[model samples]
Structure formats: structure tokens, C-alpha cells
Target chain A: MDMGKGVGLVETKYITVASHPHELTLESGQHFGPVEVAYETYGELNQRGDNCIIVPHALTGEAHVAGRHTPEDRVAGWWDELIGPGRALDTNKYFVVAANVIGGCCGTTGPKSTNPETGKPYGADFPLITIRDMVQVQYLLLKNLGIRRIKAVIGGSMGGMQVLEWALMYPEMVEAIVPIAASGRLAAQCIAFNAVQREAITGDSDFKGGHYYPGPGPIRGMGLARQIATITYKSDESWASKFGRTFSSIRPQDYYSLDNRFEVEHYLDYQGEKLVQRFDANTYLYLTKAMDLHDLGRGRGEYREVFSRFRGKVLSIGVSSDFLYPKYYQEEIHHFFKQAGADSHYWELISPYGHDAFLIEFKKMSLKIAQFMQTLS
Target chain B: MDMGKGVGLVETKYITVASHPHELTLESGQHFGPVEVAYETYGELNQRGDNCIIVPHALTGEAHVAGRHTPEDRVAGWWDELIGPGRALDTNKYFVVAANVIGGCCGTTGPKSTNPETGKPYGADFPLITIRDMVQVQYLLLKNLGIRRIKAVIGGSMGGMQVLEWALMYPEMVEAIVPIAASGRLAAQCIAFNAVQREAITGDSDFKGGHYYPGPGPIRGMGLARQIATITYKSDESWASKFGRTFSSIRPQDYYSLDNRFEVEHYLDYQGEKLVQRFDANTYLYLTKAMDLHDLGRGRGEYREVFSRFRGKVLSIGVSSDFLYPKYYQEEIHHFFKQAGADSHYWELISPYGHDAFLIEFKKMSLKIAQFMQTLS
Candidate 1:
């Protein structure tokens, strides 16, 4: 229960799918191929290769699920707290694969990836991707790695959406799915948030129709988008406790200037600026689209029917203060599983961190995740 | 109760305050002079002069509270639903005066107003005003109108904040005050939302340090700011009901394009674009600053002590699902009144309209306001 940083110095590995003409037909009926998936694995694959958990990254996350790439890499993986020896995923007992999704801009192929045919970065030519397409790329990567069956697929936020898709796309292969802080469909307000974020990015004169590469294009817009998004990721309680109208130390005497920063404003500006450096505006646009388009029942029948058809057990967890994906959404996902007669469990993480509780409340999340996995064993 | 615009056509009137050297000192110790307040009045002043209610407008709202400016105007005032001959503010019973806040971009003198000191628009030179300063401006306008005692002050959102401030500033003149879907002080999240909005406006390259006037300046930035503000204004239930995952009718086949719009996104864009035509970015920045600095217990002691000192009766109202201000905010306001042993009533308007419920739920708000008024009579 207290395993910490046991998965050490894990290196990212890459594999290609839909090579040459991308024989992969997208959900949009379009053919896109030659996708490179960047992934990292922890623990060993047993002879049966059945004890493997796939850790899907959330939006803006990379394939580093645990451990540091180098001793000086600053910090461990994004989910380093929950996926290691004796941890929630318990790398000691199960192999774990974490991947950068198809439309991501990390080491994976995406809008910033070079197009094989044109021999240039895809840039604006990147196809609109769906959660299912992302799941499909992972499937191909798994197939190539001889990961014929996954013990469980676990993730939070957009990662949770991928977990849901994994259960639907490869039911027999995924024995269980733990989707945390996710929704069957994006909420209208969420879509609106995404719209404004996109607008902020593209509204920048330097955007140049999303071809603003080779420069820090639309940094201000991306910063604004991040600031907006950062607001949704944290709750009212979190902000009140952390900031609460406290003026910033930056020129404390200048309250009359429009440039005066509230502590919260400073936090938002800092976050926005920090994110733009490691992230791309084009990828942000593409990933949000995938998220907005994420629907468990899209093209498929009702979520109840689709979930009922899946043989895997489901653990849909929600953070109580997650306004982005409200707690009710996780209940709806669990309800769909139960109504469809599939094995289901619903758990709410009582935290004020909002959508970010999944990443912040590691102890609570691990405890619940571990308990849910025990039911299957 | 169904007055049905009985107030009829009303003309907006203006009054000046803080003439030279800004005889009025702001909470920031800065002197802001020659503030022209735009206001509209309903009903005639009764012989008792005690039957009057001062209405304070929310951010971006003008003083025209309950009637059409022109017979040809498409719609009546913003809160026309609750103020008329037989409405909540009932012109037949009580005189109601509504004024645009000092930082507002309405007919009121604001950032867009010509500064008599230099014969140029204040632009960014507008002093940082607080809810208290706004109340002072209203007091001046009322004094100019030869109005004395007031029956009540009622407003929602930022209006509600002013109502709270009115009770504190002029405890004796204001008898009863109703603050709906408002906070005693803005929540940190609300401040954060305001921060990003200000960021969006100022982030615009054309903002040019807040002097981008006469050229339709920062249209995109203002649009983005509005889009963000619009999202926070409504509740999740309202958005899902109004525009759940619906695609826009604009070129449905081109979902792959980054330019593709979801119905909700289109709605946000439309709202953002529509607002820019009337509102100025500098005003948005200034007004949001005022709201951010709105703390009921700033220079005063705790809210409990402040309310304890005020002799006014308070009817604090909250919408059930107002996430921006949150219903707990109203509860907090009511709790302060109770803890201070003051005459107070807390009424929750059952609404999924969120912070906007005060504006959208007219019938319920009217009925509650009428019921609250009867106690004083």
C-alpha cells in the first residue's frame, strides 16, 4: 500500500502502426496511417502475458507513467505515485504500459510529427482524432508487443475516456477498466470551454492558420487558454484556500494599476506560461477535439447496452468537486454498466481538488483503486 | 404579479459625482472624479419618500432596469420581468431606481468616457473602484434626485454584491436589501475567472495597453473573454439541457477541420462576438477588477461584525445550482447576518440557471421579492 517510486529509470520505447498509407480507417471514415506510439513500461511480462495493465495518459500528459528517464530529469512520471512496486498498479505483480496518444505532441506522432509522405511536420494537416482512434493506436502497439491480453486498463480524466474505449474496443483483452474523473460524453459547458481555448489559440495573429511553427506562436493565447482551463481543474474551495483575494507580492503598492495581480491571477498566468513551453497549441486543439468527441455510445447504441455487452468489470471513480466532469458523470458510467448487467463499481473521491483530485489525492486514489482490483482477484 | 412591462418606456437619466479632485476618495485612496451615472427610474416618489428601491447593475449591465428605451427597442430592460406596475419592484407601490455601476461601459461614464482633466478617454487611467465606491456613486445620484429613505435595494450577481455593500455603507437609509445569487465577497474561483477574462482582453495584441479605442479594438480578445464569462454564468444542467453535444449546422461534413464548431461552441462564439459589438475591453477589465476587490469585510471587520452594525434587514437569495458564486455563498451571507443577530431571510431560488438564475428565473424571483417586501409593509 505504501510502495513509492519503485519503478525506476524507465525508458520510453516507440512502435509504429498503420505503416505506409495508414490502412487504419478512422471513425470519420478517413484513412490515416503510419502512426508512431511512444510508450514506457514498468515491471515484467509473465509467460502468460495476462498480467498487464495499460496506463493511458490524460490530455497534456506523456507516456511517462512512473520513474525518471534520467537521474536529473527533475521529477518522476506524472503517475509515479500510483504505479510501481506494491503500488496501486503494483508493477511487481503486473506489467504496466503507458502511452502518448495518437494526437499527442510528446514523442508520439501528431500534429507536430513529420508526415512521411510530405516529409514535413504534419502541422495543420493532422487529422481530427477521436478517443477511439487513440485507443486503436494503443491496440496496434499492444498487438505488436505481444500484449495479447491486458489485466486491466486504468486512467483518469481523458485517460478514463480511453479506458472506457479500451473495454469497448477489445472487451476480451481488457479484463477490467478503471476510469476516474471522466464522462461518457463531454458536457456542453466543457465543449464551450474547449471552444474558447481553441479560439484563444487560433485568435492569435501569429497562429497563421495553425502553421505557426518555428516560433513560440500564440503563447499569449495558449496562456489564456491554460488560465481558463486551470480554473476548471481546481475547485472553489481549492482556490479560496490557496488564494482567497490575496494580492500578489509583485508591486504590492500598485493596487490602482490594471496590471495588479491577485495571487490566483499570478498562479493562472504562471501555469499558462509554464504549459506553453512544453506543449503545442496545435496538439491542444486536436486533443480537446478528441475529448469533446469522446462518446461511449457514439455510433454504438445506448451506453447501457454497450457497457452491458462488455465482459470486463468497471470501476468508475469521480472526485466530488470535479465540476469539469461532475461526480454524477461517473455515476452515470457506473449506472450504464449495472443497467447493462456488466460488473460495475462506483466510488467517489471526496476532495476539493476538482478534476485534479485524481493526480493530487494519490493516497485516496490508490487505496480505492487497490480495493477495486481486489474484487476481481 | 404579471405586470407585463407596465413600466412602459423609460428614459435613462445621468448625474455626476466627485467633481474636481474627486472629493470622493476610493477604497484604494485614489480620487476619481466626474463620474456620470446612467440610471432609469420606475414609479413616482411617494409622499413618504420611504417607498424607494435602488437597483445596482451587475458587470456589463446598464442602468435601464425595467423598460424599453425606445418603443422600437427589441426588448425591455434587462430585469424588466421583475420591475413594473404590478411586478416585484412594482411602480404602483414603490419607486425603483437602477444605475449602471461606475466601471460599466453602458451610458455611464467609464473607461470610454472623456476625462475632463485631459479631454481624453480615461482608457486605462480609470481608478480602481470597489463595491463601496459604486455605492457612494449611487448615494450621490440619489442625493441629486432629492431621494431620501429607501424601501430596499435589490440586485442579483454583481448587483447583489452592491446590495450587500449598500446595507453596510448607508445602514439607516436602506431598510431592507435583497442580494440574489451573490457572494458577500467574491469566491477565489470567481476572481480567477475574472483574472482570465482580463488576461484575454489584455492579452490581445491590439489592446495596446488599454488605449485601443475607435478601431473596434481587441474584438477577438473581448470575444474570448465573453466566451469564458458566458460559460461560468450558466450551470451544467442548463448547458446540457440547452445544447448537449449537438453539432452546429455549419458545414457538418467538415468535422475534421479545426474550424468546425459544436452547437455549444457556436453558441459561445456567437455570444462572445455579439457582446464585443457593445462592450469595451477596458470596461470589462475595470468592472471585473471592481468585482474582484468586492469584499464585504475589507476595511470593515468580519462580515458578522459588519452586519451586526447595520440596522437594515437582509433577504439573501441563492440559486440552487449557481457554481460561479455557489449557493453556499448565499448561505454564508445569511449565516453572517444570523451570527450578527440581524433581521435576515435566506431564500433559495430553485434554478438550474446557475449564477444567471437571478436573471432567467423571473417568476420565482418576483414572487420571492414580493413576499420579502410584504414583511416590511
Candidate 2:
């Protein structure tokens, strides 16, 4: 049952999906290229090559989908428990590949990558990319690796957006998909949340127009932005259950000062501080913008037209307590797919973790995914 | 149907709830006094001086409850829709009074007031006050005005917190209470939201340790804080319906720039900018802290013990779409008051305005409040 021992140690590999000067024309009419995709693969692809499954990571996630980087690594990949041999994806029976999306700040080419034109990090110079653009990059990676037909593509949050995008763009190549806690088009409130987060980052005096490459680079603003994201990621019920009026410490004086912390405040600060240490603020800005602009039917006609192109089987998983991407979006995904006469189903996972339920409520999510994967045949 | 003629022009008046040298010991074990309460009245006190309805204003609200400050004033008070002659409170039939809470920046004695000890603005030096302390000051105001009792105490959001506090503190003096979108004790998530808003104000470089008087006083940070508040004040469905995918303007370049914004972001910036112009950053810090510290049973007893002392009739009004203070809190308020054997009824207003429903969906809220008021007579 141990995922680490089950999958063993894994190594991340990188490939330039689009070599320099060979631009990948994006959905935004911008030519972005020399794109790199960092990914990890588990299990053999099999002789027929029909057993491949793609795992896409969410915002702020890297290409590592399961297993430890090294035997000594303390943390496995984000979806370690839900993947691996004998698990939902069942690495023993299927070949799985998880790649970092374009415009990501991992081992992939993103705002942090050097611009061929200037020899400096792209930063805000990175062109705005959409969910379809990210899916295109994934397609390039798969094609380069000679993995033709996908058994299924699965992910949550931004990853889920990618999953749906893949099915829409390549219904013939991908057979099944599971999109969890994603939106067809982001709600106005969600866009507003993203807007404020970007505002905090840019509002910081240290932001330096996204050119502060060597300096600390808007750490405080990014921290505040992360804090806001953390608040929305979880359910109000979960926060109440976890932190509920508790002071940060037993110190009496901490209760009287504005600077003093609540237990929840301390948790948020830790989350903020942690992300700021590893993330580039410009990437945060770009990725959030991508999310804000994530409309499935944009430039692609109406909902009926968008759903008509996809004939893949779908399992849309929604989290009942999700605040950011409510369960309704997934239900909408299923409803539209069904209306288009495509094979589609939806399961709203009842949880207290809000939009983060897919990540935190691993056991429940694993069960649902495993049941659905079993039916994929 | 003309609200202007219904209530007519009204003037705000101020009274010192506590004179110099007469310190009111606070919940924090700090002595804070010489407190002034700013208020406005409509109609007249009856022969028995008991036909008075106290309208406790919410956070960032003022003593101006209804009517215009001047006949030519562009905007009426926050609750002008529900407080005119033929409205819910019905000024033609009942005397209605609204007071600014302490720690507020309105006309009340708050962080903006001059501290007698230092002869400067209190700023963050203002003692950490609680909902109970605000209620106590209101009690003093009624006593000084020679009004013996309140026919009912009504409010929404923070005002609702005050409504609950009034019934708990002086049960014999307040005949009835209507707490809309309030909590028995604030949810931990609500406290976390307050914490972040305070952090933004205090984290600002120009805050100068909360003594940024004579300067712009953390306008950027306060603006960001207000923007965050505005998002929470609205429902997701409302935002989708109101500003979905709309650009700030018709500028073609706005679609490509991170600095350029969506229609929702533009609206939020306007809200933030407007608030920063009128509000003091230090008061924002102090008032939110007071709210975070609001606990019905704090320094008193268990909720059952506290509610046992209040015999006032209760009408707890919940808002179905309120993000900040969800309807569940109001329902919880009703549950506790009823369990204590107090005359309590719960009503959840279904509106898409979220927490702002009480302030915006006035016709629906009016029907409920007016019916409740009718029962009181």
C-alpha cells in the first residue's frame, strides 16, 4: 500500500517540445517556442503502446506526479497516493506520463526561462498562453516520445482544464478523461480573485515591473497573494475545524497586538512564505492570467459546438465544498457532454476541503478514480 | 415611492458616551474612555420613550443611517432603502436611531479620535475593543439621551454582531433583536479574512507602525484590502451575471497585458480607491481586529449561559448567498437563542447579492423586517 515502495524512486526528464526559432503558434496569436516539457514516466509503455495515460499537474505543480526524487527524499510527488502500481492509475498495468505545462516555473520553459531575443528571463515578457496552448505543448511532448494513442488523460484544477482541452483538441487520440474541480469558463468571482492576487504582486514596490530577476522580487506581495490563494483553496468548514479562534501561541501578549497571529494566520503565513521561496512572481502572474482567460469555447464557437468535437469517455469529478471551482462546473461539463451524445459521467465528492478536496481527501478521490479507471478497460 | 421625500434630510449628532477621566475598562483589560457616539434620529420618541429602534451600523458604516447629509447630497446613507417613512423601520411610525460603533472611523470615538493622554489620533494605540464593548457604549448613549429602552435593535453584518451583543448585554433594555447575517460567535474563516485585511494595512511601508497620520497612510495597502472585502461582499453568481469575461474597457491591448484588467478588477479598483479616500488605515486595522476578537462567550460564559440571561425576542435573518457571513451563522444564532428558551425565529433571505443582500435586496429584507416590526407592536 506504500506508494514510495510501490513505484520506487523516479527521475524527472526534460525535452524541448519546440526547438528554438521553431515557434509553436499559440491560441493568443503569439509565436512562443523552444518550449521545454519536464516530465516523469512510470511503468512500461507496452508493445502495443495503447496503455499510455497522461497525468497533468495543476497550477504551481511540477512534472513530478508520483514517487520520490531520491530514496532520501521526504516528499513524494503531489499525486503519489493516487498513482503508482496497484493504485488508481495502476502503474503496474499502465504507462503514465505527467508533464509540466508551458508557462510553468518548474523545469519547463516559462517566464523564468531565458529569452532568445534578450538573453534574460522572459519574466512578464512571456506571451499569454491559454489552456489549449498548454494542451498543445503536452501533445508535442507525447508526439516526440512516439506515444500515439492515449488510454486516458486525467488531472485536477488547472490540470483538469488541460484534461478537457486534450479531449476537445484530440478526440481521436485520447479515449477517456477525468477532469476534477475545473471550470468550462472561470466565473467572474474567480477572475476577480485572480485579479487581486496579481494586484498584490504588482502593487509591491519590489516588483520592479517583473524585471527584478536577481533581487528578492516582490516576496512580500507574492506571500500575501499566496495567503489569499490558501484561504480560497480550503472550505470555510475545514478552516473552522482546523484553526477555530485559536491563538498562534499560548503567549498572553500575542492576543493584544495587531501584529500578533491567530493559528489560522500562522498557517497562512507559512503557506505564503513557502510558495514565495520556490515560485517566480511573474509565473504566478502569467499562470493566473491563463486561468482567468480559460474559456473552453473561446474562438471555438458555442457550447454545443465545443462539446460536439469530443467523443471521448469522461468522468468529471466535482468537489461539493469547492469554493473556487465549485462542483457545478464539473456537473456542467457532464451535462454538456451528455447533451452532445458523448459518453460522460460526473461524481461530486462530498468533502470539507473545498476546492482542495481532490488533493487532501486522497482516499475518497482515489476510490472514485480507481472505480472509473477500472471501467476504462 | 420617492425615498428622498419619505425620510427627508437628516443630521448626525454626537454625544460623549463617557466623559474625560471616566475610563471604561475593556475586554482586553485595557482602560479606554472619553468615548463619543455619533448618531442620527428619525421621527420622535413616544410618550413612554420606548418606541425607539436602535440601528447599529456595520464595519465601515457611519452614524448616517437614512436620508441625505444635505438635500443636495449625491448619496443617501447605507440603509436608506430600508429606513425611510414607509420602509422597514418606518420613520413615520417609529423613532429610529443608528450609531457608529467604537473603533470605527465614522463620527464615533475611534482610532481617528484624539487620544486625551497623548493629544494625538489614537490610531493603533486605541485599545483592542470587542463587540460587547461597542454594545456597552450604545447602552450608555441611550441612557444619556434619556431613552429608557429600545423597541428593537436591528443591524446586518457587523451591525448584526452588535444586535446580538445588545440582547446579551442588556436584555431588559432591548425589547427585541434582529441580527442579519450574523454568527453566534464569528466563524474562524471570518476571523482569518479579518486577519489578512489587517495584515495588508499594517504590512504597508507607509503605515509607519499605525501612526501614519498627515501622510497618505498606506493607501495602496488599504485599497488592496478593500478590494478583497468587495469580492467577499458579493456572490459568485452575481459577479458572473454582472461582469463575466468583460474587459475593463474596449481597449484591444488590455487582453494582452497583466497590468490591464478585466471588468471585475476595474470595479474592485474603483471600490478600493473610493474607500481609501474616506477611510483611515489605522482604523481599518483596529476595527477588523475588534471583529476578529468578537466572541459572544468571551470573558463571560458558555453560549448557553450567556443566552440564558437574554429574554428579548429574536429574529435572526440569514442570507443564502453571503460569502463572508453565510446564512448558516444566522441559523446558528437562531438555534442557540431558541435553545435558551428565548423567543427566536430564523429566516434566510435567498438573494444573489451575497453578504450585501441585506443592504441591496432591500425589498425582500424590508418585507421580513417590516413583518417582524409589526409583530413587535
Candidate 3:
């Protein structure tokens, strides 16, 4: 899994946890894991190890947060734009770490991973894991790397969910927390979208009740799910600006033909097909379900009460056009942080990319992160 | 199709047009028909014959504008609340007529109708029709009924598109026009949603190239499409207020189970299943495609130029929270209508039901329509 050349100098590494007699207990009270996590690191750990920044990957992201492992790899890391030397993350000044979450398929122990007991892929039998469970695994990974205090835990979308959990669960261990394009809990509309996506996968005849592995898999269903998701990742303004009413150059001879008519249709199809090539369908279901279960005050009290536990300097960022985790969600986090007497700040990235602005608008994000980090003593 | 008791006196009737010796030509330059339009009328034609108001059905709508055909019928006409005596259309004072659109499956010539050439169901082979084509068919139906002049043409959603077309295509015949929750042209985001829905239906293996009729049909795909559509029909605020984060009463034994955990999920599923029971998948595809092609200015110069031909009063209504056909779309229509020197009025319905407000907020709509009608004569 070489990420390619001339990208970054970081290489992915793995650590095994809950192995042997130790099993990982999930939020569902189900315990069945000898889990392994694939991670990547940049820069060098300092004497105090306080400069270590924990970067968690989003739902479809991987441990390869920056750089290319091999020259032949066409695509660089997901956050390659902001994670290199002198970049927003500035690997030169900070020790950065990113890992694939518990239910992710990118070199992590997930549904694609084989169960030691049954010697078979977990598939639908995989235990349900939550955002907190993912953070716990990353905690173990950080401990294994001999790191204790974190300079900051920053991420966007699902990754931001983990950042929130880490800051809340280990307030003293983290000095600063930045959660971008994320909310304290999944909104009803967000949950509805996720539900339809899951239905798309599960309803596929090829899914065979999530046992479609070792075959063609639910490619069509997964593609359709991706198609649905890609729409939400972008805003109406972005789509209109990028691929308006312009018909596709490849027009069908018959006006009634079901060929891709609009350029936007072709773009969505391309995105869906691209994701199907690199991602696992079952893991998509698992991760999205984990997201739907992400409520900071589930068993806790009010949101402000839960956020009060974090003493870190909070820098919450929101995307103006992000309908998935609208700006109001970020504002709530900032409001609660300030109400709790914590040092908090909020910045909105004005972009039409919607929830995906966090990924696309790297230059602006990097500038904001750099400025925020400078004030974090 | 008996519409049961406790309903108004309207009874559905059908008229065949472009049948046998005559074939209907579509906007796409393709021809195929022997089209039948199912219509229902309320009230009587006045001596002047100028009190006839044409009401066009939206996508998935029918000819039953009010009343029940039988005592056992459970579902009344879609616009029953707004078309009865003292209501919006005011059957007491106006002769209101509603007809199933040309590409509809509700007793109309559509994908489910028999293709005279093949003597089989048209299915996917149904020629693509547009808003203007649907207006043309309705025009023939109106002419057959011996109604040479229309007091007004009013509708919402796709129906609204037809209303716009009717005012433009038969300007001299229509005295007033009302288009609700609709635009002169489909936006990129709207087109994108339609494209994904079509993909959902066409991708279903069970679809068998839209030849699933006489079989189980593409029930799963159609259901998924409906699920996706139901989300756009309502606002996020509406869903949050109605369903919130409340989990379904039936909790899964395991947190990981793919059960419908949220009330919104269950609600969407119910809607999907409900639509599957009555609608044909191929017709959904055809109608959506037709909507995507609804550009009033197409082949006609600018919007103002096309609208200038109508010497009628225009009352354009918009829902405050409609994301699919936002208020801006309605504003555009009003802007152009005024620019073209037509007498026009714009009303915004304050509602949380999103695009569905036009269908659900009947009382507000009725008041507005009543006021607008007073100025029409």
C-alpha cells in the first residue's frame, strides 16, 4: 500500500490492540475483537511529546492522510494539500498522526478483516462501534507510540466527531481541539440520508443480507449510495456553477434515450464508480451507522454539560454551505464551549462545496489552523 | 377507481386524443400516441363559457381533483381541500377541471399504456414528453369538452410547469395563471436529484430494462427513488420537529442491527412502500425526465420574451422553505412577468413543509387564490 512518490515522506504503520486474551468491548456491549489499526505519522516527537497532533480520518478516508507511498500511485493522501512541510498542518513544526477508524476498511481491522475465532470476514457479524470506540483505539495507538499529551486533535466531518470525543474523554491530554463540519449529534435529516444510503446497499439483491463478499459484491447498490452521497457533499450553488444546465457533450441520438444528459449526471456517475473501486460496501454501512449513533450527550446530560468537561482551547470551524452538518451545529459547539467558561473560537469557511468544503478549501483552512495554533501556547 | 364516501360530486372521465389515424408529436421531435387524458370537473360551465379553470396534475398526481367515486374509497383527490365550494378554486363560482398529465400512469396514456404499434405496454419505449407536450394534450382535452376559453390555468410542482406552458403556448385562451412551487426551468440541483432517482430505477436488475411490467416490477428501485424524493419534499425543520432524534419505538437487540432506528427512517420507508403500491416505475422515470426538460425559454427567446405573449394576470406562489423549488425560482418568474408588462402578484407561503407546503397548506393557498381570482375578471 505505497502511497506514491514526491508527495510526502510519511509511511503507514500498524499496531495491534485487544489481541490474545484481551477483547475490545463495543458500545453495543458486544465484545469480539483482536483489533489492528493502520496509522501514519509525520515529523519527529519532541522531548515532551506535546507537539503531537492527532488527526482522525473521516467516514471514507484512510490512514494515508498525506504523501504518496509509491511513485506509481496516482492519487495522493486525502489531505495532502494541507499536511506537508510548510503546509497548513506543517509537518516540519508538528508531529502529526492519523489512523483508520475501527470500522474503516483502509488497512484497519473492519468488516473486511478476518475474525480470529471463525477464520472468516466479520461481514454483518462485526460488532457495532461508535465514535468513542474509535477514539479509544486511537488512544491505544498513541500510547503505543509513547505519546501522552496532544498539541491538538483536529478533523472534519466523521473525523471531527472523533475529535470531539477525544477532547471530551481526555480533556487534560489534549491542549486544543478543532472540529470542522461536524455536530454534537447527527441531525434528523442527516440520519434520513444515511438511512436511505444503507437501504440502497442492503436492498440490493446481490447484498444477500451483507454476505455478498467473496463475490461481485453489491457494486450497483454501493455505486448508487455513493451517487446519493456525492450530492449532499456539494451545494446547489457549487453544482450550478460547476455543471449548470449544460448538456453532456456526448448526446444521445434519440431525445428519449436514458443516456447521461447533463454534465452533472456524468460527474456523479464518475464519483460513484471511483468510490466503488477503492471502498468496501459493508464498511460504508458500519461507519455511517456509527456516525448516526454519534451523540455526545447520549447517556450524559445536556450538550453544554457534556462539553463543559473539555478544558482545551476549542477552535470550531464550519462550512457556510454545509447542509449535512450546517453552520448552526458548529455554532452550538462554540456556544457551549464559551458558556462553559472555556477559551473557544469559531471561524466559518465561506465555500459552496457544502460539507466537502473542509476538504477542498485547504488553503483557507490551513491559514486558519496556523493562526489558531499560534495562539495555543 | 372508486373514491369513496364523504367526498365531493366530481367524477373522473377520459377522452382519447391523437388515437389511430393521428399520432401526437412531442417536443423532442418524436411522435407516439393515441393518448388518453383522464379528467374530473367540478361545478357547471357558465352561459359565457369563460368561467372554466383548468387545473393540471403534478407528477404522481391523478385526474381525481375532488370527491370519491364510491363509498369504500379511502383516499380523496389530491387537491380536494383547495378546490371544493368556498375553497381556492371555488367550485361554487368556477368550473374547475383537473386532468392527469400525458406521461402519467393515472388512467393516462403513459409508459403503462398499450403501444398501438406493438400492441404491448410502452414501458421504457414511451417517447419522451415535455411540459409543453403535456399542455398540448390537455389543450386537446379542453377543446374536446367544447371549452374554447380558460378563465385560468393553475397548478403546483410539475403541474405548475404545465401552467406556465399553457399561458405561453395558448396565451389568448387563458385569462389568468397561477404557478406554485415551480420554476420556469429546472435548476442544476433539481436535475441532479432527478438523475440519481432515474439511476436508482434503471440500475435495479429487476427493472429488466423497464420491461418489468406483467411482473413484480422494479419495486425496490422505485421504493428507493421515493425515499430519496420524500426527503426533498419536506424541509429539514419540518423533519426535525416531526421526528427529531427520537429512535423508533422498536429498538434492535444489537446496536449494530440495520433496523429503522429513527422515526424519520420509518416514515420515509412507509412513504416509499406506499408509492410502490400505486405507481409504475417506468412512469416515474418518464415524468421526472419530462420535468428535467421543463425550460420555458427553450427554443423561445428569453424568459421575458416568451412571457410577453401572455396577456393574462400572473399570480406566482412560493414556499418559504422549499429547497427543491426555492422561493428564488418563483421570484424569477414574477420578475420576468413584470418585466414583460403582465399584471402579476407574488405571494410567499410561510411554511415548514418545504415544497410540500403547496399541497399541505391549503387554507393559506385558498385565501391567496380567492383574493387573486377576485382581480382576474
Fnat for each model: 0.86, 0.65, 0.62
- Each candidate: what lDDT? 0.85, 0.85, 0.85
DockQ, candidate no. 2: 0.71
Q: lDDT at A225 for candidate 1?
A: 85
Per-residue C-alpha lDDT of model 1 across residues B156-264, encoded as one tens digit per residue = 8889999998988888798888988889888789989998888888878889998876667888889889989999999889999999988875665777666677888
lDDT of 3 at A49: 76
Best by DockQ: 1
- Residues A1-377, candidate 3: write the lDDT tens digits: 12122235557898897786247777667775688999999877888877898899898999998888887778788888777667666677788899999988999899988877788788887877889889989998888888978999999999999999998888889999999999988888888899889888887888887777778788888988998999888887888889878887554554456553878888988998999999999999989988988999987887669889997799999999887788989998999988888899999999989999988997788788878888877
TM-score, first chain, each model: 0.97, 0.97, 0.96
Poorest stretch of ten by lDDT in candidate 1 chain A: A249-258
Model 3: what TM-score?
Answer: 0.95
Superior candidate under DockQ, 2 versus 3? 2
Question: A346 in model 3: Cα distance from truth in Å?
Answer: 2.4
Q: Give TM per candidate.
A: 0.98, 0.97, 0.95
* Better-scoring candidate (TM-score), 1 or 3: 1
How much does each candidate deviate at the interface, measured as C-alpha RMSD after superposition? 1.2, 1.3, 1.4
Error of 2 at B32 (Å): 2.4
